[model samples]
Target: MSVDEFCRFCHKNLKIKGVFSQSTKIFEKTSNAKTVFDRLIDLGLTLKRSPEKSIRTCRRCTSILSRIERDLPVFRKWEEEEKQSDSSEQASAPKAADQSNWDPPASKMPRRVLHKFWPNPPAPNQTRISMSARRSITEVMTHYPSSKTVCNVCHPDDAGIVNNISKKNWKTAAGLMMRHKDLVEEIKVKILELVQHECKTLCNPSQGFILWRSSPEDLKSFSFSSLESDLNRLSPFLLSIFSTATNHSLPSTCAAAAIAVRGREPRMSAFSYYLNSILLHGGARKAVFKKLSKMAITTTHCHAVGKLKEFPHTCGEGLQLLEVQKEVLPTSGADGLTDSAGQDDEGIDLGGAIGTHRQRDSQLKHDLVDSSGSQAGQMCQEKRQKRRQEQSTQEEEGAEWVSRKRLRSEVQPSPLRLVVDCSFDSLMMFKDVRKLHKQIQRCYAENRRTLHPVQFYLTSLGGQLKQNMDETDKGWVNWKDITIKTEHYHEVIPREELVYLTSDSPNVLTELDDTKAYVIGGLVDHNHHKGISFERAKELGIQHAQLPLESFVKMNSRKVLAVNHVFEIILAYMEMGDWQEAFFTVLSQRNGAVPVDQNGQAVEDKEDDDSDRESDGTNTVKDNTSSMPDQQEGANEQIEAK
Candidate 1:
């Protein structure tokens, strides 16, 4: 009998079915597996197998081991190269001199070092300087050259100052200092001020260079009243860079300064990258355009910027233009027709007054004018027909326009209630909150466009998420078939009717029930808070379920869908009455979702592997054992007995 054990590498506990036995034959089939086995042996991991106790590994640990095995050789080579370079540098470097035996030259020595070597002799009637003042003076002198010439700040007279204060020059030093007593005192104060400034600069370097090395606080303190003058001082090229980086909305000098300092580097913000995308889409040359793109900034890869323009904002403007065109075109056509009729009447009057040959020529000219008019009319009719054909084609392709009044009156809302629990606001960061708000807006927009919009409920809506929604989507309060509340879902609806939809749920939902209120967690944590929604549902004692994603389709990545994506999928299914079609229509190609057969295999892969099924006898035998009814019944009997 085989017993379940923890994985040898990751130490993850695996059940009997999940355990993968470690065998030399299996290792030989994978690339670099032998090397990984040897490395594990070197690290004191036991791989010896026995009849009673066999070595086992989990699937995740096996995959990770394979990846490490493939990359280990490159890492080893890099380490060896680094060691060789370090050894070479050490071999060619000069040795340091013995500090006890060597000394710097007297002329180039620091004043602080000179003071350490020699001491001023004590004398009667000599005023003693403070230790702090002496230290300040020593600091100032360290930067200047050691010379006998008098410093103008210290000594204004043409007398030489004492550089070497020996016994012979002790009287000379005292006399020189006494002669410029007031000047020396004044210079000492100035030296202290200089040292203080240097210390301040060392403490906070941003203050010393306000323009180039400014901190966020310093930038924020800039006066907006002088913004115009400050902007004038900046070159047009720099201003243009800032303008493009901020999407042409330079709010204040602080924002401008932030861009000047931080925007030079790549991957500064999402707004910058969005601007870069806009420039690229607008036909800007890639080589010349250097703002927030990876080619220039090199921090992030390509990302999808969802909904580049707001639908309602742009759609309203387009409808207004259409209305204006409708009003102007008819009036212009009527005026042109009246002008043509008046010209025809004048031509008739001229024909009566002409001679026989002139009248004949005039009649020919009139006939030519009538033919031209008919030709113009035919061209106009053809254009109108073409326009009508385009409109009909658009309608056939499902681009038919729906008026707001008709949409509100005709389409009936779906019976199924969809609740978005926004109580997870505390779990997400500021940026995640904003992203959640955007997704909620997209959900609302999608529901409005769909024929059968669900009864939408936004519960526990407050905090930063509420503020963002209020600022961007003011009309959400007046939306039909929607309910906004500040209470939890449990308080709003009965626990029996609530069904939390989370990816971590064990129960799979094949189809939605009209009696049940489905709850989607209105949180965007980028997968950080895994199993949170499921745990919450369990704590609340409500039923929890996940979409039947794995049963219907094989995904190349994780089966986590966005909030709007889940909402849209529900709406799609409600309209189409098929899960496969709904998933296919809502999920983009990037998701890599492929429909699977009843055997739990990808359709394409299954088709390709049909010919090799007989050759792969071991896999076929294992599948048979798993699918055997007798074995399944025996396993169930053991479970019931336990």
Candidate 2:
């Protein structure tokens, strides 16, 4: 009997307890019982007592009925007014008009108004059709047959569902099922596999992976205005596989599948669309460029944003002047006259005068030899001696000026010296080395931008680090105010003047010591070689110190910053004279750096509590370090591990 019973309201099986079948008992116990009873009456249930069968309702329906009972009265009044108006309108219609010619007035009730009365109304066929039309392109595409043949690796069930989808009026089928999330994921997997397979067939890894290249004639064909356009322009092989897996000929579906594959294996596709887009539309933010690089949408931030080609001409000119001084001063040594003559000849050649200077010198020497006995020859000899004396005096004066300039630069040096100790070259991978080179370039750019830039020394610059810089960034060597040396920092600068900056050091730098050269280890080990810099500093017996990061700010990540970031922070402090401002300015919010007071409380939190503390007449501060001893210890241990 219980198995046969069902809820009269929801039509669900009444297998559980708490069934409310008796109207008399329900009205007595439940609030808003009259509305519930009236609803049951509207459902055609009689109030007469019947022992054989009664209106059974499940617990879920009972709860819902009770909850909606309060709104039922308003709905009923509105419904009654609508019914009376409809009846009056029907009666007013012309009796002579044919019944077929008169169409019933459209329902005036809003969808929400109907929902209050019938919460779970059954969906009509037309509503279902409209909803299917409104579904996403991917969902709509699952019902269409693929233009290309399905891959052998495709699941049989997926293939069958795709095949069964009719080309015309698929909505007419009563038993057809749509693919769900699992099916979509399977399609994505199949697409990736096919892409890899195709790549294996067409690509050679040793030769490098370039999916497609646009020729001069085909440049117009490669438009990156939208994903659809990009998809339409994808390589024929990729397009075919993506369309087959997604079971649609639409460019959007193929593009989505290709994007999914690219996310998994970035190097599989050339991403010509994204690359071209970045190139054509430049000046994107650094974070945007970085995000694109991380997504593998672009190769590198510098390349994507065109920063690699921006050379500081002022710095280059200064370096060129210094180089000329060094070259000229060295040539003015013991064989000064001969070297001066050679240089004069070279200068004449460079000036497009070619053999004129050499011919004049030869003619003068021949005249001096031939007219040795004549008064004119004696006069010529005296004139030549006088000219030689004048030339020697001029050369001496020029050498003295160069020496004085060199002495002034050496005596003053820069107030602050920034040394990048690039000794850990063997520890870095190829990609890390590339990243280090980019950071070094940025450091140079930052230094050159300032009015009083510090002297930058890149020491121990050999091995792969040197090779990458030489190949990619040739301007580094000629950059002004920078010294690139292949020897160790100790060999270049005195050990007494060297003060290494490492994250693991116990000593915190309170101020910038201009007298001592601050050394930053030029190693990008990706946290693989933790404390290596500090250890090297200790072994070399150089004073090591770390930036006062713990006192000024709190980082969401480890305090270990990139080389350029550290350099920029130092430069910022030198200009602003405030460590906190420098940290905030140099460290991006993306790094999760939050400003904190000297007490280690966040600035925002401190500001909010300042008024409360002032009103209370108490300046007592809570010592969080004392409260969370265990946490602090754990953090210290973690830092040590890192």
Candidate 1 residues lying further than 4 Å off, grouped into runs, are 1-409, 610-642
Per-model TM-score versus the true fold: 0.36, 0.34
Model 2 C-alpha lDDT per residue in residues 230-253, reported as the tens digit of each score: 444444557565667778656456
Deviation from native of the Cα of residue 38 in model 1, angstroms: 86
- In candidate 2, which residue ranges exceed 4 Å CA deviation? 1-413, 607-642
lDDT of 1: 0.57
Clashes of each: 1, 0
Question: What Cα-based lDDT does every candidate model obtain?
Answer: 0.57, 0.58
lDDT over C-alpha atoms for residue 69 of model 1: 54
On TM-score, the leading prediction is: 1
Residues forming the 10-long window of minimal summed lDDT in candidate 1: 325-334
